[model samples]
Target: MSRWLLCLILVLGLTGCQSSAATNPKLPYAAWYLGFLAPNYMEVWLERADISDINGLIFPRAMGGVVAMGQPESLSATARGWPKRIGSGKGRSMTGLDLPYVVSLRWQSMVEPQTYHAAFLIPDWARRKMVESLPADCPVSGRTSDYRKDLTIGLAPGGVVKVWIMGPCLDPIEVLTLQAEIEPKGPYGGKSGGKYRPLSPVVKAYVDKYGVPYGSWWAPIPYTTVGP
Candidate 1:
């Protein structure tokens, strides 16, 4: 079957499969839940450093790769982590480590998959939001969790990528926005469907439920910031 046809099949068969498994409530740190919104089929790999102060947090690349597509958004699996304590006894404090986070993605065009890669740096605003002070009643040895647990990625034609991050204690914050070096490749020599490709079933469903927030078509979404 054609790639588009296979994607359509996944849309029909994988309906209601967007939700990821729930993270444990008692965990004291951020557990990442990844979500993706796109009009085309994509293979995604997430990479992060092994040494992090956020204990138990794992990268999706370690779990192989993620297959994502559709609209509204589809979530893959969850990565759990907790805050690691520093020192000992009354002097113990939470250690928040800053590590590199990277993403490699492949989108299947008409003839082949066009690959793109980008790295995410936790912005200052997000870093501040992650490290709120502990409450007075909390033990002196205990500390607040310092991590954003949710990440969403929006993909458009021509390699436009928009990324957002949030957590239970924070609101959604856009961290990365850029147009990648994606070679031109699509239906009709890339002329017929620059941003007018018909809505796939998954996208149509999202429109039916939430309406289109991007004016008309979703692709070529306006860029808020252009660089890293």
Candidate 2:
């Protein structure tokens, strides 16, 4: 063999060799996520697989959440104000294979405590506890009654991650990842937020029909343009 051919042979021998196993290419599994919705806020609140202690994050006794499934594409579509068939509305549930992967959705939106007219209905003890958690200058609490905030947390193999909710107001589409604590403590449950009461008749209908979990009754968006 020529000097060039001998050098080529040596180079090939030093490196492991591999080739395509089949003529047809196989597609990878698409990354579909459990699209957790933040009730009336109409946003992709977060995404995750079921981890223990997640209930507190989703169904905090003080607030509620709803669940759905989506692709990265779907979340992008939602930000543009044109959510596809999967986006949910008040009293509606969107079902798909991903339904089983969802942990849950929080029921309260930043506006819920205020919009539900829940201030007067809160038990005195719960109200007092909320007041004590804030600064003396920040006397009021409950939903975003006098303030607005968004929280973000993430999880990885060895640890959890977070993007502290900054700003008094956040975009509805802001995404966060957080640790799951088997359950949430008494944090959110605006009056009629459904922490203690039966699901609204309309919310129950969706649950019964789809067998999907939902938090509160005030979905402000429709699942489809034609309506669900």
Candidate 3:
């Protein structure tokens, strides 16, 4: 090939490589919504998977944690303002998967303390979908076409927990479920302090429509998102 023709080919090859590198799959991102369903507030926290329990930091602290306010409302104004775009590539779980973070929940009962714990993992397939969801940034295109992601966690009475990945472009994915435990009534049931608060309206509506169901830890949740 002529000198100028060869240089042109090399330049084009470099451009293609750069494009591929820029688009390589990255850690997925999503907003995290957390809520508890008991009569009194619950304390919740997230920690790096490998962090020593003796030294790991917890989000929001105990007094300012993600409280058990009720079921998180996705369409409400509060939804948009929840913590967003948490980046994760942390420790590994026992199964050799990429363990991003561990979720810890604690609450009190009339006679004893209760707890629920779980971890979030990322799989190969989710990484691919995250890459595909990347949107173009043209001044005219705007962000309307962008794919939004949300990871919602709900903890009910008796340590029952449910997690789901929800977004406009994809159907909701139920990632984790923890079975309910039979326990003494907490403050909510007027068993302890004689103070009572009903479950949040959203949670109550769901219970009214469909009674609480039993479940168990079936699968590790895939971490699409968590708090900052």
How does residue 39 of candidate 2 score in lDDT? 26
Best by TM-score: 1
lDDT (10s digit) by residue, model 3, range 140-225: 54544433244345554445555554444444445556553432443333355644334446644554454443332233334434
Ranking by TM-score: 1, 3, 2
What are the RMSD figures for all models against the true structure?
15.8, 23.8, 17.6
In order of appearance, the predictions have TM-scores of 0.38, 0.21, 0.35
Better structure of 1 and 3 per lDDT: 1
Report the poorest 10 consecutive residues by lDDT, candidate 3: 46-55
Judge candidate 1 against the unseen true structure and give its global Cα lDDT, from 0 to 1.
0.36
Model 2, residue 13: what's the lDDT? 31
Cα lDDT listed for each candidate: 0.36, 0.24, 0.34
Q: Is candidate 1 or candidate 2 better by TM-score?
A: 1
Number of backbone collisions per candidate: 0, 22, 3
Residue pairs in collision within model 1 = none
| Candidate 2 Cα lDDT to native | 0.24
Candidate 2 RMSD computed on C-alpha atoms after optimal superposition onto the true structure: 23.8
